[model samples]
Target chain A: MYPKKFENLIECLRKLPGVGLKSAERYAFDMLEYSEEDINDFIQSLEDLKTSIHHCERCGNLSEDNLCEICKDNRRNKNIICVVQHPKDVIAMEKTNEYHGVYHVLNGVISTSKGIMPDDINLMTLLDRINDETQEIIIATNPTVEGETTALYISKLLENREVAVTRLAHGLPMGGHLDYADELTIIKAMEGRIKIK
Target chain B: MYPKKFENLIECLRKLPGVGLKSAERYAFDMLEYSEEDINDFIQSLEDLKTSIHHCERCGNLSEDNLCEICKDNRRNKNIICVVQHPKDVIAMEKTNEYHGVYHVLNGVISTSKGIMPDDINLMTLLDRINDETQEIIIATNPTVEGETTALYISKLLENREVAVTRLAHGLPMGGHLDYADELTIIKAMEGRIKIK
Candidate 1:
């Protein structure tokens, strides 16, 4: 229905998550309407993102250099490290602006059903970093069954380590309604109930 | 929250429709996981779409060359022209596979509220094509009030011409539910009622 170039554009747009045929068509047509300079800027950004940014050697997080911004910031707590499943999770944690600690990105969780093993995750550097300099390690994986499994496995692996190991507190979210909450959430919320003044 | 290049990529991805900050982050990180060659191919496709695809000189539809594929096809009914509002609409019509006639894209409709006038549309070429050789002209705009206005305007403009000017049949679609149909649609269905076997 269109030129080869236009069809090629639609195919590329389709690669984005949740983008269907109609959506890809809309995105392609909209991009074609942009100025040539803006389109060039977009393409340049894509190239830069693919070529420049890479995993930080210190914490296994995304960075321009060997060390990420968090790792380079002396003001942050170097001893406290938050372990997460992905680089995007690191972004989510940063958005809070509350934590002044560094992060260790595992890049993925160990799922036995999916054939993902503990060795497949970025945990070797983490173990090497678990020296006297590291005071605490917080396992902040998602609250799924796989996440809990991975967290438990990591905590057990660090049983002989000198550093303190902890997992994220699980309970009902703020402003959550109990009626709509799942059984696992209810149990966690019940067990972690706080005392009222 | 991320590197300069990563942030730039997220900003560019945010230009897409329905993509929020989280969705943009997800899209960028997902692309980073893709192979470098695949990323380069995607960027090439984007550049080609912006610099190559343009309105056809013959019928105002998208074309790599001067004329669109539909207009260049000798097998199609060139004399029976289907007038549409946009290039995307031409794609939609082609997807039906029922239309074998050539197309004339007006690029836009007469929206009085939006200050879009008849001169803003690509109507001169359409008028030039309406000679003795032309047999029929189908006004196949959307189902909106603006579409109806454009169709009426076109039909009235060709009142003195020798060609038969027509509009798409307004009625209940096949396998449509009468109960769920709007009042205007039901009225159109009643007006355009056909004989049953």
Candidate 2:
């Protein structure tokens, strides 16, 4: 409905994840409200993101260099790795501040419905890392059926290997209200309950 | 936290309307997934939005040139002008394709809480245009207290003018369920109901 330049921008923005036509236009038009200096800075930020970043060669996580900050850090638990489905999960886990271990991003879970296979993910590096002998491998994929299937597959592959395999404990989240928890969640919480010594 | 470049991009994205830290990170990471050429093209789109567009001299609508497309197009009804709060509203009205008239963007509504006054809006050129003798002025501000206040203020200002002052008729929106319509909206609908001859 707008000019070619404006419409082209909307189309380009729609290419971004989760952004629909209305949202793309909103983003474009909202950016127009920003000052020239701010807009230039934003453009510079985008350029930097594009030019200076890549997947970490070691862990399949995002990085500016060959190794991500977590993999490069000597202080972090180098022997322990938490396997997640995406980089966003890495960010989410990092926010907890409870886990100081490194991460291995599988990129995506095995989903036949989505046409995603084991080969399509960053599983090769994970298998190679496991063969090299890690202290522990924590599977922290989402609690979905696909996540469970992927976790089970990876655990089975690492069964013969000399590595401790663990899954994120299935329970109600720490801050979650008990009253709001569904029957399945309640059951999982009850089944996963641990004795405090 | 991620690399400096990635974090910077997320921060910049967070400046957009309705985008939170999580969504901003998602946008940055998704953009990272795009090829270099595609990312560069997106950067160009943003640059075009920033550099090429400005308010129309005549109606305060968005334009690459001095006058917006609507103002430049002589085929549009110059005699009837619809007053709106922003360029977004202009697009919304345009989508309906019901109004052949031009528009005058207030740029902002008068909000005491936000410290926005009538002086802050694009009123000077509106007065100049009105003095040039438009046949009608349609106030299409959002149906809020601020909108009604602005509409009434503008109507009072144009009391002595020859132009017919009109407000967008307030009523239950077309296809709206009566069960969901608020009491105020129902009252407005009743008050504004037309006799079916």
Candidate 3:
């Protein structure tokens, strides 16, 4: 119901996560109204993202160089590594201003249903990064089944390596009401309950 | 917490309607995961949309050439013209397969709050197209206040002209419940009530 090139642009916009056909149409129409300079800037940004961004060699996080900013920061504790499933998680963690240690992005999780195995992700590089001085390996993957399985697999691999491995706690989120949270979350929260008094 | 180019891309993606910062970040990350060929194809589509697609000179509808397909089609009724706010509305009307008339896209509507005047849109071109052969002008702008205002303004403009002016019916949509409809819609439905056999 649109011109050929307009329909093509809409199809490309639909590739973005959560964008549907109707929303894609809206975006395409909105872009059509954009100024020529604005369109050029938008195209330039896409080109720059494709040409400049790559994974950090050490932690597998997104970076414009070989090493990510977190990996290159000398002040950050290198002895402790927080492992995650994707680069976006590293940004989420950093937003909290809580994690001082560096990160190790797995980039993928071991999902048997999807046929993803231990050999598929950045697991080997993680092992290579661990050394005599490395104090802890925090498994901060998501609370999903695949995340738990991957965390268990990694911890099992490091069982005899003399380095401590730990998974992130699972519970209701901060400010999350009990009535709204799912049963699985309630179960985990009850199981991991701590005595404050 | 993202690299410069990655953040830039995220900002650009946020320019799209309904895409917030978090969703923009997701899109940026999602695009990063796309294959090099896929990325190139996406960029090519954007370029094509910018360079190839333009307004149909006759009707102001989006087109790859000077005249839109509908405007050029011999089967459609040139005596009847459906005036709408945007090209998207033309697509919506075409989906019904009921309207065989060509469209006159206003490209905008008269909005006092937004400072949009009838003179700012494609109103002049619409007047230029009207002649003694033109049988009807169906105003199919949206159901909003601005739409009503624009419809009234256009109808008034053509009051002196020879062509007949009409507005699309404002009634409860098919399958719409009267209980859920707003007061204005209910009033309009009542005002436009038809006699049963």
Candidate 4:
């Protein structure tokens, strides 16, 4: 066994995602060797994370203020909204540099097995944000069952509304080998095939 | 592309061993979900690690007090000392429930490639601790080139002394299959093999 404080630090480190007992112990040992300034900076950062960051009131993305960077950008298309499962998906979408639309983060998808319902996530706020000027509503949730369920539920809610609702294309990704493509993806790709000629 | 404070927290988490950018981001996100109490507790643990823990004055093992638990214990053999490369090795040696002697942590091994020399570690302090009451000095460093070099160097220094110097035996570990054993390990096992009656 290690000293009391050493063990306590290990326990704290172990609470992080994917860190095991060995890794926690190793991190604790490594952190002990860090300079006082580095330790203080780390502590300050953690403290700031708790005190400063909050979800964007408009789009549900992480933000230091009420609105996120994307939501505040005037050039981004407010009429076209891309609905995603989490704030991280907003980052992924931003990396593409193609879509100029703002994002609506659901924070979670509907999972019946996990007992999460339609009312559990940021779904209704999305509907509230849609105005007469809103042109397209893109359902960009992951292709998983829960993501599909949430997407379908959102589309059903917008059925009476005039806004165009579309799901992201499901197919074998670019640069991916055909042999590695799964049956479901191949089927979806075939169903959504376009006539190039 | 996260918030400033979120990015700062990720950078801090990335400094930990085996944590990459993605993992650090995930840890930051997960930590953001932690209760204020939990975050404060983690911060307190890190602070305690810096303030409370110190090297044992006698054996160089990690301790809250001036002397380590083993050094202060009356039941342990004061006549024998196990010289290890790091404090972690003391924990490993203690787990065996054998070796009732106190430990001397070298903090590091002599490695020419890494530019570590004899004077860089706790080598001289070990010499000071070797009094007339000391009987055996067990070299429990790892069986690497640097470990072997340090062990040989220590033994040579104690050649004229009354204390008995010994190296830990190298062989196929217990529960190891011979078919899976490496050639060097097999050779060591053969050399150290005991004759059956």
Q: For every model shown, what is its TM-score relative to the native structure?
A: 0.85, 0.82, 0.85, 0.86
C-alpha lDDT values of all predictions: 0.77, 0.76, 0.80, 0.80
Q: Give each model's clash number.
A: 0, 0, 0, 0
**Root-mean-square deviation per candidate:** 6.4, 6.2, 6.2, 6.2
User: What's the lDDT for residue B155 in model 4?
Assistant: 88
TM-score of chain A of each: 0.83, 0.81, 0.84, 0.86
TM-score between model 4 and native: 0.86
Whole-model alpha-carbon lDDT for candidate 4 = 0.80
- Between candidates 1 and 4, the lDDT winner: 4
User: After superposing candidate 4, which stretches have Cα over 4 Å from the reference?
Assistant: A170-197, B171-197
Candidate 1 per-residue lDDT over residues B21-63, each given as its tens digit: 8788778888888888778888898777676788889899988
Each model's iRMS: 1.3, 1.8, 1.4, 1.1
Candidate 3 residues lying further than 4 Å off, grouped into runs, are A170-197, B170-197
| Candidate number that wins on TM-score, 3 or 4 | 4
The DockQ values of the predictions, listed in order, are 0.64, 0.56, 0.62, 0.68
TM-score of chain A of 1: 0.83
Fraction of the reference Cα-Cα interface contacts (below 8 Å) that each candidate reproduces: 0.78, 0.76, 0.82, 0.81
Q: For residues B53-117, write the lDDT of model 4, one tens digit per residue.
A: 88898888888999988999999998888888888877766765656888899888899999999
Candidates 2 and 4 compared: the better one by lDDT is: 4
DockQ of candidate 1 (2 decimals): 0.64
